[model samples]
Target: MSFIKKRTSHNYDIYESRGHIIGRITLLTGLIFTFLPPLFLWLVYGIMPPSKELINGIISISSVMLPVSIVEILAFSPMLGTNAMYMSYLTGNIANIKLPSAAIALEVAEVKPSTEEGDIIATIAIGGSVIASEIVILIGMLLIVPLSTKLNNPVIQPVFQQILPALFGSIGAYYILKEWKLAIAPLSVAILLNLVGDLPTAVTIPLCILSSILTARLLYKKKLIKVTD
Candidate 1:
């Protein structure tokens, strides 16, 4: 029975194998969509942006964006797990929409992320969110002209401009309220550094992540915050 069981193996491994295959297929499809459009434009027009200008643009964009993207992958993957990552990257908006939606779903389900159950919950949440986002985008596309006019109208511009800040502020306030002790040190440092007015944007982000992590560690060691199992 033992030998047969060993040979038979666990079903979870099979699921993981199939998941990897699906993820790779999705990644390939995403890459095709990404490159095919630009290639088509270049082929049809027989025109491309100036090589030097494109190179400079790439460099300027990559220098700042690449590091953040790498950091985000490292920082977020554990919370998102593999299935969620596939869905998130494919659909876009990992930070603003997918990640938050996954986090909230996991919290509601009372499951720690990266676990099997968490992966299932995250995948479901992200899938639903992707559908909902697409529907909203379709509606927006249909109303683009009117929406753009209203948004750009002088009376409404301030409100539109403030929407992002207000949204993040409310979300941040919710988490901070839940665990204010863990948030204080990082929030304080961010506020102080921002007041300096000359610090590089790239430097500020990693500094904030590090400071918050270290602060949390110190608090945990001091038992100011109870460590969960």
Candidate 2:
């Protein structure tokens, strides 16, 4: 028996497939993680107005850019879940405005296989679509420039280096340290990362996670520690 699959069309139906609770969890976690840092920073700034750092207006706009993009994204997501070509053939059929936008986005993101692999094509397509959506938003912002706020004043950059990491570390230490064993791995890895002059979280977090999991497993296996699910 062959373990090969056939070429499937990358249409709206791809997203149409239901029941991805893991994806939902990821999204919810995003909603939590992305906001909390900036919020705490804003609060701290408000409280003791940093001497060197001025919170510019653009930063404020950039801060809420997520919720705004989310609102726009939700407002225009397609409902029909049909092929883009078919949708283009009959764009008027869709009763909703958001459907057309989402359809357009799906069309933008669909991969056509070349000499390269399918995954590469899909990655390019999806990345292109995200860039396109951001471009559209930027265009909209330009149209209403007076209404738009400033983001990332130069003054805040240096301050961010100190405040952002401290905020995350403090919070993680507070909540995740309840389990002392789980706590040690992060502490160790954090120190390691700092000593190594800082790799990205992409490298740092996975290392810590794998180390913690293995440490926990080993300790339990040797009867040095107990695990509770």
Clashing pairs in 1: none
lDDT by residue (tens digit), candidate 2, 46-150: 554564454675565565554544443332233222222122222222223323344344345553222123333333334444466668778887876654333
Could you tell me the TM-score of candidate 1? 0.88
Clashing pairs in 2: 57-150, 58-150, 58-151, 59-150, 59-151, 76-98
Worst 10 residues of 1 by lDDT: 6-15
* lDDT leader: 1
lDDT of each: 0.83, 0.49
